[model samples]
Target: MFAEHLSAFLTHPVTATVLLVIGIVGITLELLFFSSGLLAAAGVVGFALYFLGFYLAGFVGFGDLAVFGIGIVLLILELVVPSFGILSVLGAICLFGGVLMAAADPKQAGIMLGIALLVAIIAVAVAVKYFRHRGVWNRFILKEQLTTDKGFTASPDRAFLVGMQGTSITPLRPAGTAEIQGERVDVVTDGGFIPAGRTIVVVMVEGTRVVVREIFEQNS
Candidate 1:
């Protein structure tokens, strides 16, 4: 009797929406901090509870779980490997599809996801504004700029690199070095490998990340 009530409550629209928000916010925090495993664990627990509740109610299936798992793998790969956002898009689709599959109806799924996403976005914005210094991105980047005498020169804005042609200094199996505008810059391919000494072009530049693509000649 208690279990039945619990399941019903968990599957309720309000409860499910709250769980989704918690899961999204928790995971976002984990990514932003990348510190102790606590945040990640908490996010996982939120998702687990939500899924378990649905499962207990017989609303979820193995296929849905598989799709969700694939989405997770793709998202992880997107973080570890740069595919120019392709993996991110596909992963998001799969994740949403999985959740929708488990939802009681399409309208309910849309409303829940929309609300959860909006709340999560606001929460993340607040967290970023207030906790900028504690972000994990700080760990990977060098904040200090050294003088020229130190033999390390700070790079100027790279926005101009777009549309510039260059040569690959090393084989880019997605990420490698390239010589652009007489400067050796670290670059990543859209999603393919370009051998060393190949002609390449800067396709896009986001902050310090320079994306390049191989140039192929067409035979007349």
Candidate 2:
């Protein structure tokens, strides 16, 4: 009796399409926008109603609902934790499988899935472009510029060290310490090994990186 009532209500093409659109939009907004989980909650409710309607219409069963719920949970986890795309992929697979299984016609399912995917992609692109500029997004993004004008310097200016002669104080298997101009400085060789006490010439000094070469090799 319940199934017959649900079928009557959902039998209208317009009604079913509206429900599907609502579900897709809600989920897309939840995933793309950070709304303190409010959007997520609304999305969950929308999807639950969608699945319930299908279940009552006899198009889907409890098994399909379970799969869909698991998929939603996985997606939520993807947002909460960094899974390196693993959880998101699994969630998408479970969601698609559940939707396919509940759909009576394969052609309709394919069309609906395609539409959902397209909408999701557009939503993500828009969010990435505009959302980061918003004030709320600033709380999550690092917007500070570390520059000399801001009194922020990663290392002292070593431009004067360029062209200076030095001796390797430690073996430089690409990187080691060197004594240059009566001061100890960290240095790196240009793909060459230099033993301790070997004479070296500072070839380049860029910020904190002091690049050097063997003095003997330069003459030879």
Candidate 3:
């Protein structure tokens, strides 16, 4: 008795409509606004709930790999093909076919489509956030400089930091990694092995490398 009522409610257009609304809102916040990953997650959950509800009720199969596979192929064609609008036609065909096959029940199908849109929005948001904040550069997400690229600005000479006093955080066995004043650097020595947690002074900064000398004597 309870299970039948649940299925009937799941098939309700109003329930599916509410799910669609959630998906739309999630997508909107993700794409048009700067945000964290939470809003997008909410959107995905909203959609996923709908998909599961419909699939269990025999609406359509979200778990169908063939439908997904066809969609992917269409996506590939859209990227690689060079006709006037053949890619768009193929892509649309694939989408419609996959969607139609998965939608065994009209109400369930609607819910799954709604959720898919929501998932897309969240994916875009994550992609943008990851690319925007990463140290390395990617062309798609990096539209403008969020801030001035302030990092190890490379120089062409060795006399830049020749007199800066520093210490090695890592053992520099003539040629190893080290840090000076919380700034990590690749350094070499005069064939002298220096252990980590020791004091050294920068004698040269040549192109991506720094040369250091151990300091044992201090004015008292």
Candidate 4:
């Protein structure tokens, strides 16, 4: 009698709705807050409970459960490994397929899937807008800039090279090396190509960028 009642309860639409709500809330919180994996753990537990309910109600088989687990694993891998979005796409497909296959009713499954997708979208938007620089995403993106204040320099200051004359060591198809004051300096032409061995004058120096213009001689 107890077993029958339990099965009925697990299979009930109201119970399914409750489980869906719990799962969605758990996942949203997981994404929105950096809780040192506590929120993520709760989300995993909520999803596990959802699958367990379906399994006990005979709505999902072992194969469907395995697929769902694989999907979750792939999603986790997407966070750590950079597959250029292939893992994320595959994970979404697996998750959707598993959920749809586990449903006893197609209409109910569609509704539930749509709700879950909407919730996920909203949660992601909130996280991106408000918590962009604070969460797990920081691990994948570079948020620091190496500046002079940080004791980082791309090249030594070439400000003194401005207005200095030089000879092009190689054809400046916009950029090439030049011998200025006996020092080989990398330089770029002013939107014009200069042939090798041509006399050029440094017109501008901005940080590592040394701009030069070809010099033309006039017969007296």
Whole-model lDDT values for every prediction: 0.83, 0.75, 0.60, 0.76
Which pairs in model 4 have colliding backbones? Answer: none
Best by TM-score: 4
| Model 1, C-alpha of 58: deviation from truth (Å) | 1.1
Error of 1 at 65 (Å): 0.8
- Across residues 38-104, which tens digit of lDDT does each residue of candidate 2 receive? 7667667655655666677678977887888788889889788847668877886887787777767
**What is the C-alpha lDDT profile of model 3 across 43-121, one tens digit per residue?**
5555555455556677655445356446445544544553454754665455445544555554566565666566656
Task: Please give the RMSD to the true structure for each candidate, in Å.
Answer: 15.7, 6.0, 13.2, 5.4
Q: Among all windows of ten consecutive residues in candidate 4, which has the lowest summed lDDT? A: 25-34
C-alpha TM-score for every candidate: 0.60, 0.60, 0.34, 0.61
Off by over 4 Å in 4: 1-6, 21-39, 135-142, 161-220
Instruction: Summarize candidate 4's per-residue lDDT along 33-78 as a digit string, tens digits.
Output: 5565676566667566666667776788888888878877886776
Question: In model 1, which regions exceed 4 Å deviation?
Answer: 82-85, 136-141, 147-220
Q: Which scores greater on lDDT, model 1 or model 4?
A: 1
Stretches of candidate 2 exceeding 4 Å from the true structure: 1-12, 103-143, 149-151, 162-220
Per-residue lDDT value at 220 in model 4: 100
